[model samples]
Target chain A: MKIQQATLHHLATTESTMDVARNLALQGCPHFTVVVADTQTGGRGRMDRTWHSDPGGLYMTLVLKPDMPAADGLKLTFLASLTLAQTVRRCCDIDAGVKWPNDILVKEKKLAGLLSEMQATGSRIDFVNIGIGINVNNDPARFEPGATSIKAATGATFSREGLLDEFLGALKTGLQNTSLPSVIQQWKTLAVSLGRPVTVVTPRETVTGIAEDVNESGALLVRMSDGDLREICYGDCFHR
Target chain B: MKIQQATLHHLATTESTMDVARNLALQGCPHFTVVVADTQTGGRGRMDRTWHSDPGGLYMTLVLKPDMPAADGLKLTFLASLTLAQTVRRCCDIDAGVKWPNDILVKEKKLAGLLSEMQATGSRIDFVNIGIGINVNNDPARFEPGATSIKAATGATFSREGLLDEFLGALKTGLQNTSLPSVIQQWKTLAVSLGRPVTVVTPRETVTGIAEDVNESGALLVRMSDGDLREICYGDCFHR
Candidate 1:
């Protein structure tokens, strides 16, 4: 289905786009509503990690109200990462690959991070806020090691508005292909974490295995050393 | 591992025990920390549904910090439900059975409702609060059509503190048996949703099938009429 028309809310500064966008969503904001901020003081990533939101970076949250099961909500993360990588490749002429879940890596250096939070009743989702922190002109490497920005990678400053517009367009088109099998198939084409030896650390236990593939629900399927396959729904993945 | 000592926080009245217990959990309260309220002005169930927290009911929340992934956090709901059923059987002589996720049913009538909320960093769970509202001496049938209390079921008044104490003791023992297979196995013995035709309404779709069994993570497995088996992770199960 065609996504609703994009509604943009630009803020000079905010605590976090996720909070602002969540408030708007709870107040019955339409789907695809966007909240962008110049900077954030309390930006957060997956697992409640702090996200460095420098002034030159593009920090935004997209409010989505998809008519899908809460379990399928994580598929949007994969869709987003794939679309972002494609967007980066098209707009900046830089080849970007996606790490498992939703991290964009340009030549094995972090370019963008995505965090999705949802509130659901039973299996139905009320709304999901996809918080995105893309290091465009900001020097993320100064604060976080192994981080890279578009300007640092290409040595040319790009317009944040143009990049956001291009990304939104691509995402709007991507939302039309929301089927599980097709989305997972398309995402695997840009995945960098698959077909590699990796260690995934969850709260319960750590599993070291070959990153074989991702399931239709977007869970990482790993082939362990003991001939057992482990499906990691969510974890901190490290490529060994 | 041995469970921690019990810590109680009794309130004459509160907005909700979940909020109070969440604050306590965030403030580093010990595991098995208990927060009880004589009445709740703003009680809530799963999916943000308003919980009818009238007087003469046992309303409480348990703070747990299990060293498990967020994916496996739902297992705690099953564990809680099973323990609650056992508690009712032993204390009130009422044969309580669990309905799918976490509702306690006595003779096909609702006796209690359980809601669990958690916060995690990646797959690591920081804390989980299990909110429980059980009808003790209260006439829940006055408000909820299909709900019953211990008094209504057995024609005898029971002490709220006694029920809470028994449940906590049972839960402490249950915490010792946290293995996935064992917890799911024990939970299955008291499950009323299994081996029956159930209509599950999720946020995405409505699935109707014969409930076969529960997986290790406490997800319900259903055999569809189309000869396909579907694993429902979270949904509202209605017996047909």
Candidate 2:
């Protein structure tokens, strides 16, 4: 679907744009539909991490009905992370990079985060709601340490609409390209976690390994201390 | 988690067993948990098809947390379908088999159905709720033309609790076996759709194909008319 064909719903305040986008997807909205909220009362990230969605932050979610296996949906996380970093670089002229799985950072500090949810029947992906939160014009100092926004890092404000447009364009290009290898190559260039010592934690156990590379299925390939390459699917990654 | 540790809340009427199981799963319920209702006010099947959930039918759902990839969860569909067929064969002495993906049939008529829902973060499966419905004593004469219950097929009344026990045992065995190939082989032995002429319909279009073996990913591998093997993840299948 064309990016311009996407309906953009602007909300002054809401619980989450992701929830609203999910409702639209359930109601049979077409692909590439978008939902944006200025303030979210209950914004959340991956692993139930709470995100401070104040007025200056851009909290947006896109409803995509990609005709691919649910496993292939993991590629979208890398696609989105690249788009966010590219948008930050272009809009604010800062060197932005991606952390493994889903965080976008500038100079080893987080500037944005992503959370995606999917509904499926059997192996077919029904629809995926990818929620993107970027600290555009927010003051990260009041939020937490190691969290920095475009405005906080550059000491300049940004237009949420402008940055969102840039991201949607890059995302459209990436989504239309079905070549997983090529998209992953682009992500590897922008990713900062490769070859770094990290700890990955799942609900059951935790493993410390050197971040090697993301496999074809979008799982992180980590080389453990025992010299075994483990594919970690779901976990929290911490740089050591 | 143990099967007996699961408290069976017998309800006279409710919306769905899947909904109740989901609530319990969210509220810190351990694995192998179960919820069974005597009657359902709003029963459902895969693809939003409604099951005749009147009194005498078994409406049940179980929550299982397996440490595996989300893709592996598809095996549970094949697992539950086989379990339902085994339950019917043991209890009613009828030759029951599975229809592709998620339906249990006796002589080409649907005897029971399976619906599985999943919640996850990335590729790790958080918990899966496998909902099953068997038309035990419910008279299907007035229900639908292509449906039959155990009582209608055989002149015998069976206890719902006994059949549930048999199914739970079979399901536990399938869930514990992390080997997907063996589970698929078992399902293949009991599937009626293999090596048959079939029609598959998605929201987009319909295709005629020869039903082939299932792939490693639990998707139906169909040899389409164009001489290509298509792995259909989601669709309605009709045996021609």
Candidate 3:
């Protein structure tokens, strides 16, 4: 939980920053330790899905020891996304919004993505790695389905280092000052999926509900068709 | 989720099988896969603690995609300890009991220990690795304070493969047939810390209470001196 002990490792190319940061976390790395790679050979997303990691994107992973309950894992993810959205807004003129759970989108197009890994002993969480891969200076056509980078969205290239510094600076301040409720309120302001009808798809089942608000743990509290509140902690969400 | 896809790796020495199995799981390895090392160079316990891994001990980790709720991560740990305790009883003829969250002990001595890792996307759990290390045939003098091997306790050598095969066979059956409720009940039967005065230690605070029972999530339900039931999901427990 010592943010002042932050260490940064910049790599030419690696399989994944998350993998490297994971090894560092295993070696008892302090909180806010970071690993950034120019390119990743084996970047991954949720469910072991492949993440396209070309050279122009920003690939970074931060190792954190929150010393909070297990539910704080969810809160960390939301905190990460909120900072990411804010960074995007500051780095570019476009108003970036967060999709429920972990995606950042601008104008209904995918802008950046996040993946997290948690290592724990029973209920005691040891460390969490928040891996972020943002399409910074790449062509949207390289990735699929409405993906846009800063250049693509604004037609002006931006410095990845500038953006990374901005994002991490904001993150350190946010982590130090913001309460969970306040973080949730800020996230609600930049949320694009809340208050909309949405379909969330899991590997096993699909649930459709009115996307209400997220709880303190960053769980999406959905009011289902049966008037029951379902706090979904996992899934791919599509805003309708 | 495919138990049939179980693959076992037996090695003379490795850093940690949990690290090896985690790589496998990240590469989309199927569930129920296992990694066992005859000797480990760097075994680990919870909260960044080092687990001594000399030769003649059973060091193993199972990579499973339970696809359950996040709380099921706790259930998996209890299930592993319960099965391990049962295997020790069957192989060594000594009663083994679980210490609320992590350690399994025989007659107040440490018999085995467990560590778990969970990866998820949102509320969807991707995979969980429950790593277990047992003092099967090691010299108790080599390990410190309260350590006892099955051979040291019963004065008989037990086959490493034999014990592992037995535990896995029983685990497969237990995972398939027994409900979580039944599993909890079985765990309750082997609980040594329950129904007694205990102290729980977290990073920030300590609490003393009666170890009433664990809930469905394998969280210890402590009846505090304040006459309230506190559901403790994380901490080190000491029985008084």
> Of the candidates shown, which would achieve the greatest lDDT relative to the real structure?
1
lDDT of 1 by residue, B205-236 (tens): 89999999988756789999998999887778
Best by DockQ: 2
Docking quality band of candidate 1, CAPRI definitions: incorrect
Q: Across residues A15-99, which tens digit of lDDT does each residue of candidate 3 receive?
A: 9888899899989888889898888999887667777888788888999887765545666777889999998897787789999
Score every model by TM-score: 0.79, 0.91, 0.73
C-alpha lDDT of residue B13 in model 2: 80
1 or 3: which has the higher TM-score? 1
lDDT of 2: 0.82
- Rank the candidate models, highest DockQ first: 2, 3, 1
For B149-224, candidate 2 gives per-residue lDDT tens digits of 8988887888888888778877777677776677878888888999999999876778789989776666788898
Best to worst by TM-score, what's the order?
2, 1, 3
Model 1 lDDT, residue A103, Cα: 91
Worst ten-residue run, lDDT, model 1 chain B?
B118-127
lDDT of 2 by residue, A1-240 (tens): 123636778888899888899889989998888998889999988888888998899998888889987656666766888778887888789999988788998888889998788766666677878898999898765878889889988989988877888788878877887755677788889888899999998777898989999876667889998899998877888899
Q: Is candidate 2 or candidate 3 better by DockQ?
A: 2
Better of 2 and 3 by TM-score: 2
What CA RMSD would you report for each candidate?
4.9, 2.9, 5.5
